[model samples]
Target: MNHDKEPAKTGTKAGARGLPVLESETLFQGRNEIVIRHQGAEYRMKITRQGKLILNK
Candidate 1:
């Protein structure tokens, strides 16, 4: 089930670096691939059938 309806929490644990922790389930939202745009460049991030993450430019 998608948990995006509720706000996802970041690093709230003690001694944590305070960086955001994003769950793949929410980002992908039941999809296998997603595109991220940064600095005018596009990157594709997808979950392989083996359940590993692969990023391509």
Candidate 2:
């Protein structure tokens, strides 16, 4: 459970509308690809050689 209210220290920044900004570098860490599971569905996110992000189902 996360109880922190501040987004600055959580690898996210608070936007003007209070929305959290997630950093891709923080999400990816050292990997170029990551898997996201949502609502029993699997998704793949990858960084291309040109450093572009692509998401696939």
Residue-pair clashes per prediction, in order, are 0, 0
TM-score of each: 0.72, 0.69
lDDT of 2 by residue, 1-57 (tens): 135533333534586666677778767877999988899999999999999999999
> Model 2, residue 52: displacement in angstroms?
0.9
lDDT of each candidate versus the true structure: 0.81, 0.78
Q: List residue ranges in candidate 1 displaced over 4 A.
A: 1-15
- After superposing all C-alphas onto the true structure, candidate 1 shows an RMSD in angstroms of 4.7
The Cα error of candidate 1 at residue 52, in Å, is: 0.6
TM-score of model 1 (CA atoms): 0.72
**By summed lDDT, which 10 consecutive residues of candidate 1 come out lowest?**
8-17
Which tens-of-lDDT digit does each residue in 1-57 have in candidate 1? 246486654545444556566788867879999998889999999999899999999
